[model samples]
Target: MPKQITRAYEERLLRIRIMSHTGDKIHIKLPLDFVKRMVKNNALDFLSGKDDIMDSQKLLNLLINAFDYNLTGEIAYLERNNGDIIRLIID
Candidate 1:
């Protein structure tokens, strides 16, 4: 019999948490499609040559920029160790 391969369902959305050394944190959820689109749009500049490198912070900034432009819906929360919490929702 031939070997069979199975494909898993593609993830459509993702949630991530970022924290600073000062104990400040932010939670973000975004659609994978939005990230793909951003990467595609910037591929020319970011992926022009094999020697080019794109860091995670740069990608994070791109996502933040997309949120700023209202390109997609997002939910964000900011938490501080000093008992302060802030919530933001954008669509």
Candidate 2:
């Protein structure tokens, strides 16, 4: 890691930016080496459906999954429960 990348730059660099008509903005970023590992683990398909910003649930899941945490149990539980699950998902 020669010439270390500053936190600000590193943070911005991971973002996946997109521009849209009607003055809408969309930003997506993942941690360093996220895609590489997911690729190696054969989980890159999870990155799909990201371009569809209209799918709020999908977008929320992708953002949380970015952290590589274990939320499978919670996810399964939510499948049984109801009400704007995004709160529980993100929490």
Candidate 3:
């Protein structure tokens, strides 16, 4: 049998932001459960680019582990030379 992991005391949210040099910005907030469901249903297929591929299973595992480990805060941040920014946060 596989070992079961304990869930965190509180639920978390995933926050994503995309900003363009032209002052355009997009922000998205999703509950963890919704993200897990989306990953299971392959609804995040757009995450893969022409030459880059993201494994759904791996992404699911990461999400599971995030809660298991009680991880919170910014997990990814990127800034381009053109002054655009992207950020991924677990809160």
Query: Which number leads on lDDT?
Result: 3
lDDT of each structure? 0.49, 0.39, 0.70
Better of 2 and 3 by lDDT: 3
Off by over 4 Å in 2: 1-5, 8-13, 41-91
Order of models, best TM-score first? 3, 1, 2
* Deviation of model 2 at 51, angstroms: 13
lDDT of 2 by residue, 62-88 (tens): 544643552222231121122211212
Error of 3 at 31 (Å): 0.5
Kindly list the per-residue Cα lDDT of model 3 for residues 31-72, writing each as its tens digit: 887876887787866444454344535655666677568687
- Model 2 gets an lDDT of 0.39
- TM-score per prediction, in order, is 0.35, 0.30, 0.63
Compared with the true structure, model 3 gives a TM-score of 0.63
Best by TM-score: 3
Candidate 2 residue-wise lDDT at 2: 61
